[model samples]
Target: MSRITTVFDKLRQQNRKALIPFITAGDPEPALMVPLMHELVKAGADILELGVPFSDPMADGPTIQRSSERALKYGVGLKDVLSMVEEFRKDDTGTPVVLMGYANPVEAMGYETFAARAKASGIDGVLTVDYPPEESEEWVEHLNRQQIDAIFLLSPTTPQARVEQVAKMAQGYVYYVSLKGVTGAANLDLRDVADKLIRLRSRIPIPIGVGFGIRDSMAAKAVAELADAVVVGSRIIEEIENSAKENILTNVYRLVRSLRSAIDEAGSKH
Candidate 1:
């Protein structure tokens, strides 16, 4: 089984929710990327969503957009992110790492080439924000050949027809964007999310991970009550962006640990 499937299965057995934390691969700097990944794992992240820095990231809000800008300032690209993953694999081999970014870089690298290199670098999944399920058959085929999960995004606005499409093509888990706006927007209604998830669950057989607008432990805990996973991005990037160079890892670890504890509390209730 793919690392992602294995991890989710294991979590299911333990009645625990997966905590997937996101970070731009070369955010603070390329050198800190691998270490930051390790720190996240140490702080109880079940899976890591590593962002590839792109010049144009339309789905991301200002917090994550700033993260991409900082990483791009050092000229970090798709290959550089893959290399960082390779370096990370030297010490840790089991944690699933999902590449979360736009389709432009993957298309530029070619799907076949990108899939092969991603497999070689120990990637477990890919979440290309712009690759709608309708247009990703070949893309899914390439990753399937490499035994890597092709993750997809489903938003509140996603239709039932598209949900069925994603259910057929998607591996790993489906990311449900809880809010209608970009990554950092707020005012998430748990009742709305709960209602949507009930409808999505009937169509999607795979696990659902809720993200976007989940900024604190309270939000994470609430989402964890209804979803198999809770994905936190902008909040973590904001933690990195606001921390001092020397204290970045420490601060992020503390924040993620709190999230972990909160999610676990919800899981225990379940």
Candidate 2:
């Protein structure tokens, strides 16, 4: 099995749900990234999503967009993000690291080169928000050849046929958007979201992870009861944004640990 598959299998065996925390690689500062990553793992993050800063992040909310902008100002490019991951993997081989970003930079880097560089840098998987399943066959084949999982996102609005196609193509967990809008939105309905995820679970073989509108421990715990994993982005970014550079690591550790325990408790109740 792939590294991602193995990780999910272990979580399943323990009756636990994965807690994925997202961070822009160079947000706040690039020098602080490795320390932040270590703190996240120390606080019980099952998987880490290292976001690459893009010029136009269409899927991200205001918080992540500002974080990406901060990263860009620091000259955090794709190569820099890979270097951060390379440094992170020197000590952390157990935790799966997935790069989440847009396709514009990947295309600019050339598909084959991007795939090779990502694998060589010890990245386990990638989630390109704008890459549709039908249009991703070639890139998916390239990444698969390099032993890297090509993860995909499925929204509540995704049609049944496309959901099945994405499930068949997705190598890692399927990212199920909890709502039909951008990240950090309000008024999320757990019952309606659970029903949508149940429909997806009936069709997909891979683990399903819920994101978007999951801002606090309570929301994360609720989502964990139904999905295999819970992903938090904007809230973490908000923490980083609100804190000074010296305190960013400490804040992230505390926040991630709280969410981790919350999800674990939710899973236990199930």
Candidate 3:
């Protein structure tokens, strides 16, 4: 099985929800990327969603956009992010790493070449924001050949027809954007999310992870009760954005650790 499938299976057996944390691969600086990844694992992240810096990240809000800007200021690209993953694999081999970014970089590198390098870097999954399920058959084929999971996103606006298509093509897990707006937007209604998930679950056989407006432990705990996984990005980026250079890793570790504890608490109730 792929590493992502294995991890999700293991979590299912343990009656635990997976905690997937996201951070731009080269944010702050390229040198600090691997260390931040290790710190997240140490703080109880089940999977790492590493963002590839791009010039125009339409789906991301200001917090994550700023993060991309910082990483890009240092000229970090797709190859650099993959290299960071390669370096990270030198010490840790089991944790699944998913590349989350726009499709431009992947297209620029070519799907075949990108899949090969991603597999070489020990990447377990890819979440290209703009690759709709209808247009991703070839993309999914390449990743399938490389044994990499092709993750997809489903928002509140996603139609049932598209949900069925994603169910057929998406591996790993389906990311359900908890709200309608961009990454850092506010006003998440748990009732709305719960209702949407009930409908999605009937069509999607894979696990569903909810993200976008989850910004605190209370929110994470509430989400953990309703989804198979909890994905926190903007909140973590906010933590990174507010921390000092020397304390970035420490602060992020503390924040993620709190999220872990909260998620575990919710899991125990389950």
**Residue-level lDDT tens digits of model 1 in 1-270:** 888889989998999999999999899899999989999999999999999999999999999999999999999999999999999999999999999999999999999999999999999999999998878999999999999999999988988887887888888999999988998898788999999998998888888999999999999999999999999999999999999999999999999999999999895433
Per-residue error for 81 in candidate 2, Å, reads 0.5
For candidate 3, what is the total of clashing residue pairs? 0
Clashes of each: 0, 0, 0
Put down candidate 2 lDDT per residue, 1-270, tens digits, no spaces. Answer: 777888899988899999999999999889999989999999998899999999999998899999999999999999999999999999988899999999999999999999999999999999999998878989999999899999999988898988988888988899999997887787678998888987888899999989999999999999999999899999999999998878888888899999998998994433
What 10-residue stretch in candidate 1 is worst by lDDT?
Answer: 261-270
The best-first sequence of candidates by lDDT reads 1, 3, 2
Instruction: Give the RMSD in angstroms, all C-alphas superposed, for model 2.
Output: 1.1
Q: Candidate 2 has which clashing residue pairs, if any?
A: none
| Residue-level lDDT for 143 in candidate 3 | 92
Q: Which ten residues in a row are the worst by lDDT in model 3?
A: 261-270
lDDT for position 142 in model 1: 96
CA lDDT of 85 in candidate 3? Answer: 96
Candidate 3 residue pairs that clash: none
How accurate locally, in lDDT, is each candidate?
0.93, 0.90, 0.93
CA RMSD of each candidate after superposition: 1.1, 1.1, 1.1
What is the overall TM-score of model 3 with all chains considered together?
0.98
